[model samples]
Target: MDDFLERTRQALAAQPFTQLLGATLERMDGEGVALALPLRDELKQQNGFAHGGVLSYLADNALTIAGAMGLGRAVLTSEFKINYLRPAVGATLVARATVIHAGRRQAVCRCDVFARDGHGEKIVATAQGTIAKVDELPAG
Candidate 1:
């Protein structure tokens, strides 16, 4: 793996929530990032579909990852909005994110969450987010 990709994988390994969700780094490079998650019963809702929170989580993390890659520094999501296009019922889910614009202090990113099943892939949600550089994290 390349330097950035290796570092990114390490960073992801440190995230407890990501581990909890069982998300995998499908792709990470200049083109952008693709995060994949296997759909398990624990991640579904009463309707037996992937919950909106799961989709939002994937979008939020993917946006930050894309932003950090574009900025060449660590970033935190400033804000994000997700629109659910349909119920996600599938064996796997993937969130693909790309940097739309990268500035000195921030980056705008777009992400699409798709669910994959025997039929194929279907976009279940779309999101856009602004990511800001973490110049310095405030002390707790």
Candidate 2:
């Protein structure tokens, strides 16, 4: 588990945008990956709710991580679709993702985004993503 956590940490560090979002890899297990991000004013939309892009970011990254967990290699989000079920109003956002299927070079994953508040967690969005395994990251 420690090795997996370290791998997750390294992977997160490689993504500047994910760092800007202040997302942290909370846990990774045989089932999937979990991530959390604090809700900050800067992350909110004009309506004072978490922006759709934020939720999409969370889902895409979480699902991509979940795919990589299954393959034990880096993965990229080839495509994803998200459905906003409700406004995200909370102190933090949580994303839980699991791989639905893993092929040799690609995986299908599902992620559920929840808004955590005093009342507890509520489903705000859900996503399905296709992640492709990458043997190595290309030099930028």
Candidate 3:
């Protein structure tokens, strides 16, 4: 399991967009996956809050990771919806997701995005999605 998780993490790092966002795998297991990104000025909007696109990206990727890890197979997010609970103002952002259900071809997942700051972590957004299985993931 550790080896599989490590390989998945490496594959994630190899993704150009994920690398551009500086996303990291904080945790991945039977329970779920947690992906984190450090908050940077370049990632913020004009109001100095985390961009909506950034949060959406985290939710989508985290949902896919959770579903893939649960089924021990590769998966892609078919669709997802997210709601911003509040403005994200923090040092880092973490998106944690869990597979609620899984079948032969698809998995349903839920994700919560949080912002970590000097005080602590706060929920910034929530997401739900369906992930469809694939033949295999491309090697890194």
Candidate 4:
């Protein structure tokens, strides 16, 4: 498990776009994975809210990580579905992902995103994804 976490961290750090968004893995275990992204002007939409794409991207990455953690192998997203719940207006966003099911070739995971406003945390978006396990990829 320590080796898996180390490899995941190194892989995440090497992603240029993820680094640009300042996304970090806060927690990872058999149950789930958590990721955080600070709200920045560059990530906002015209309405001054966190952009849908940003939320989707974070959710996708979170789910992928969770699936990989469960399988102990590198994986890629094959399909994803996202639902917007509310406007994301906050200092940062947090995404929690859990594996729903795992098969030999594919895994299903769900991710929920929350925005921390002054009042409290609110649901911003929800996502489900299908990840394909790849055997040939080099481990980090």
Candidate 5:
């Protein structure tokens, strides 16, 4: 289990876009996974708030990671929907993803994105995703 988790983490970290977005895997367990992204100029919209796309991408990635843990294999997102609750104008954002349902070939997960400031945290977005389990292709 430890080996699998380590390999997954390494693979996730190697994603260039994830690195570009400053996304970091904070926690991972049998139930779920958590990810964090710090607010930076590149992530901001013209109005100086975190872009909606950034939140969606973070939530998608978080849920995908969690679903992969549940399936014990690689998975691809079959569908995703996101709701924007409020503008994200904090120093950082945290996405907590939990696997709501798991089956032999499909899994469903939800992610809540929170904007964290010195004062407190606020729900900035929420997302639900369906992922399809896929076998890892043999390496040449």
Candidate 6:
């Protein structure tokens, strides 16, 4: 688990946009990965709700990590579709993703986004993605 955490941290460091969004990897395992981001003024839209792009970013990374766990290599999102179920109003947003199926080159994954809702958490978005295993990430 420690080794996986270290590797995940290094992979995330290569993603400056993820860092700028203030996202943190909370967990990573064979079954899934969990990520969290704080709801800040900078992340909000003019209506004071968390921006849709932020939600999409959270889902994309979570699903990619889940697919990578199954493939044992870095993975790139081939395609993804997200459904925004509600406005994200909360102190923090969390995304959990799991791999549904995997083959030699690609994997199917799903992610659910939740936001603090005073009582517990509320579902704000859901996503499904296809990710392809890659030997290495592209140069920036």
Tell me each candidate's RMSD, in Å, in order: 1.4, 1.2, 1.6, 1.9, 2.0, 1.3
For residues 56-111, what per-residue lDDT tens digits would candidate 3 score against the true structure? 99999999888887666577788999999999999999999999999888899999
Q: Candidate 4 versus the native: TM-score?
A: 0.93
lDDT (Cα, tens digit) per residue for candidate 2, span 79-110: 99999999999999999999999989999999
Q: After superposition, how far is residue 75 of candidate 1 from its true place, in Å?
A: 0.7
In model 1, what lDDT does residue 132 have? 94
Candidate 4, residue 34: lDDT: 90
On a 0 to 1 TM-score scale, where does candidate 1 land against the true structure? 0.95
RMSD of 3: 1.6
Best by TM-score: 1
lDDT of 4 by residue, 5-121 (tens): 888889889999899999998888777999999999999999999999999989999989988976656688989999999999999899999999998888899999999867888
Count of clashes in candidate 6: 0
Work out the TM-score per prediction: 0.95, 0.94, 0.94, 0.93, 0.92, 0.94
Off by over 4 Å in 2: none
lDDT of 1 at 38: 98
Model 6 lDDT at residue 120: 91
Error of 4 at 37 (Å): 0.4
Writing each residue's lDDT as its tens digit, candidate 6 over 11-101 gives: 8887889889889988887668999999999999999999999999999999998988888767799999999999999999999999999
Candidate that beats the other on TM-score, 1 or 4, i.e. the better one = 1
Predict model 4's lDDT versus the native: 0.90
Clashing residue pairs found in predicted model 5: none
Between candidates 1 and 2, the one scoring higher on lDDT is 1
